[model samples]
Target chain A: MATPTPTRQRRRGHDPESVLATAVGVFNERGYDGTSMEDLARALGVTKSAIYYHVPGKEQLLSRALDRALDGLFEMVADERASSGAAIERLEWVVRQSVRLLIDRLPYVTLLLRVRGNSGTELAALERRREFDRFISRLVTEAATEGSIRADVDPGLVTRLLFGSVNSITEWYQPARGASADDLADALLKMTFGGLRVDPAA
Target chain B: MATPTPTRQRRRGHDPESVLATAVGVFNERGYDGTSMEDLARALGVTKSAIYYHVPGKEQLLSRALDRALDGLFEMVADERASSGAAIERLEWVVRQSVRLLIDRLPYVTLLLRVRGNSGTELAALERRREFDRFISRLVTEAATEGSIRADVDPGLVTRLLFGSVNSITEWYQPARGASADDLADALLKMTFGGLRVDPAA
Candidate 1:
């Protein structure tokens, strides 16, 4: 073997991304504050200094994880805004896309859901989440204005419930089971938008 | 005015319960780990020893708070099960009872939701929660089997979504506001079982 390539026994260039992903997994399992850098490196099969070279510290890893989740979320909002559809159509579109975002970036979404607005970083993530909520509330208002949805309830509450429905998916969804993103969207839509109660008396 | 007796400052017999309630309020605000006995005393205008006399430690306070929430939940299940006309009736009864339970036991439920299953006591609370879930899941399965509800999806998922709809009330509910627990349950019931979409023929 030429030069005795370090790839055989060492994680060389893969250290950074691999370490970050490992950090996310650990953070999700033990929570951000509950986990330490030592635990992360041990999980990553690397020395603590090896993790340091990639990220400044655990906070940076959390920030990176949140950045990824928020990017996906904001991208979904941007795409839905541009998508030409009725308001209810747009709301459903957002729901589907949000579900996809959660599934595609499951660990990040899990971390996002667990944040309690304790840290500065977490508070920022929560604020970004509020902005996302405001976006959904506007869509719900539009849907009600279009007479596409029930006008009786507050739009904000509806938006929270909608978001809660999607966020709750991460609690039970198994990534290892290989369920597709669209499959989750299908189940959610069936239960949420489409009423579970069939219509003879509906 | 004549000098008040020393017992007057502490109230005759309600002091411990009042102190525990005050402790729960602050615990809900600051989280279990973040809160201190000093904070509890400051909230109650009592000395640190007073708090220690009432409860053994912070963990005991947490356990007491969670016990209140858990007791409410378990009672809801029992009450709903015994005082029902039909299976669907029982399900709706449980939902409304749950929303009321969350509101009546706001601080306790909030603390219960935030526990991370980190400590032994926390783990016990988590186990009790799972037992509650299994009990509700049994109701959901029985309802489906009796043909009072949709039998297409798993009963476990239905139970999760049912609580998902109720547990989320704490995120936005304000007891001081004009919005009452009944109002929340009404809106939530419509948003959940009825959904936001209009009838196709309407």
Candidate 2:
């Protein structure tokens, strides 16, 4: 099919980026399962036929939205910073980057965290999420093995709690008024890494 | 209304405690909004009429279930341990107790965490939850002022990340196979309060 006329595109007012952003906002507000194609159309201010021209169905949109979050994570996983240096340093870098990614893609990440494997797309997303968890878990284990982190607490538990704190940012973070991603990551790392208590020796 | 016959009660196999427990389980699994009275009835293995004999409606059950979690938190707030100690010690005690409370009433707390204020009952619960967060924030501030916890990080952010770790326990904690409440609390305290890094001087 030929591209739409420039005037038609201007009248529609939604590009792919805006469409996904609006769809994610609706999904987060009403929940993915509760939202409908008509809801998406209403949110986009476009007719249902126009939405179909952009995407095939709701599931396709869900897949793309989930990928927006998952892809950021996998990109972090592949980064040299995550793989190099001492295990503890690498772990710290990954956690900081994770915070940046979560903040950068707040809506998508929020949607990703709320997925419950309700459909094939959701299940796939959950699988990728688990894979990300496994990567973090390995970093924690390596940090423990290298004798940088304390040994008494289980590494698995550490991974969960550390990332749990990271994930919780999505629940309360307001970008307009909240701390920048660097400040959030610094606060989190300081609390979890250097410890929250004042050093007696200092 | 008069009580049902013992034989009938035995056949129905649900007391108030059991009914609430079962309802919370269903709520956690399917979410409060997604769950219906018919679903609760089916899960309880009783007729819809039989369910009404025990409780008035879903909202009533939700109120009770939310109370189960909130009451535990309020009880902790009322305890002498939370009030009489150094702010840092009291904060530690509160965090430990919160882990125990979340574990002890896993389903109830899980349900509480997922609430989004869609109804009067949920709105009331959300208000109570914010009150709890404020209580924690004050303790963190006190601890920082006392120079116990580090002062550089914002106390409010500290409270959020600290409890964010604690609350995340409900996401993966398995009562049958997971660590006991004491063990969980110990690990959490050691990480957030004592710090996760090994002492280089040691």
Candidate 3:
């Protein structure tokens, strides 16, 4: 109590991570542009000063939320399952993991997906998003070259279509109301790989 | 000049539709909150008053752009091809037409896809989007019931997945840089119906 507990050591009720989680939901609902420190404080049931103790301002909160989503995504691509399997197998693994990740981090991912590059943080996030897309695009290109999927669709187009479908999950998926993550992942994989892999029997 | 032609009939270069088209691009680029009437006028090489002459304000520009996208989508469902054929066939037709429409009306559709519902116009557009999604969800349900597509996936989820992939076309499909609309539609249909239709062979 003498030195004033560091932000990390703050009580369980108001940790930075928990605050960011709550912040993500508010950001997604009201939009980064429409939300303010006062709004965030009101949602968190804390004063603006309390929020300030952990982060600088709304932009930093936005940056942290984007980082949370991008980190999960980039981590999936780096996972051995995503990196080591046959190109198609690896792609399937990434796709499955991506759905699971989207469900697990729904709020953060939702905020990241909706960013319009209005701020420095958002522009950086967009660049990282493009980097992530390029990484997957390479996987699709490799899968096509290996003849693991249809050769006719341009790999870039395939990447867009596949993730477009994946990212759209944010719009409708509610973990509390809908299909289980496993069920969602299983169905998505079937539809994705069914359309992707050249043959169903294979 | 004698009749003081209405803005719609003022000139080919300054028609409402063309001005709206330009506005869509600006909205997509600047995050609707970040854009202003002055920004729009600058983009169109017109005075702010000129833009106001065609559209009442920034909100109207956003509303009109959303209407353009929503109208095309509603028209598809009302079409004989979307409303009448076997569930799968109708869905395939809609999918094909959606791709073609997204390409043809790329800017309007892009702007519509990015709205975050922060204002009256956005909230209204969001409701219409939900209506459009509900329409598609019904199609997927009918298709599943007819055994024309996989029944394991929830039709609601299927609608999201199908459109997620389809709507994603806006992220990357540049008519100037990529595949022809026919080519994009062909690949998407093959992937979409290939995964959706119950029988891969049929």
lDDT of 1 by residue, B1-202 (tens): 8886885756554366776788888877766776887887678776777766555678887788889999888877777363566666677778788888888888889889777787998999999999988877887777777776667766777677667767776766788873788887887778766778986578
TM-score of chain A of each: 0.90, 0.93, 0.88
Q: Residue A147 lDDT in model 3?
A: 68
Task: Judge candidate 3 at residue A104 and give its lDDT.
Answer: 91
Candidates' C-alpha lDDT: 0.78, 0.90, 0.80
Q: List the residue pairs that clash in candidate 3.
A: A165-B165
Second chain TM-score per prediction?
0.86, 0.93, 0.86
Top candidate when judged by TM-score against the true structure: 2
lDDT of 2 by residue, A117-174 (tens): 8999999999999999899889888988989999899888888989889999999999
The collision pairs in model 2 are none
* Better candidate by lDDT, 1 or 3: 3
lDDT of 3 by residue, B54-138 (tens): 5668888888889999999989988988888788788888888998899999988988888777898999999998998888889
Models ranked on DockQ: 2, 1, 3
Q: What is the C-alpha lDDT profile of model 1 across A1-202, one tens digit per residue?
A: 4675674457564556777788899998776877887888788776877766555788888988998999998888888353568998888888888988888889998898878887899999999998988888999999899898999999987877667777777766888884577766766666667655545463
C-alpha displacement of A140 in model 2, angstroms?
Answer: 1.3
| lDDT of candidate 3 at residue A39, scale 0 to 100 | 87
DockQ per model, Cα: 0.43, 0.76, 0.36
Task: Report how far residue A130 has shifted in candidate 1, in Å.
Answer: 1.7
| Residue A108 local lDDT, model 1 | 91
Assess the local accuracy of residue A2 in candidate 3 as a C-alpha lDDT between 0 and 100: 61
- Which regions of candidate 1 fall more than 4 Å away from where they truly are? A1-14, A48-51, A80-82, A177-180, B1-14, B33-51, B80-83, B146-148
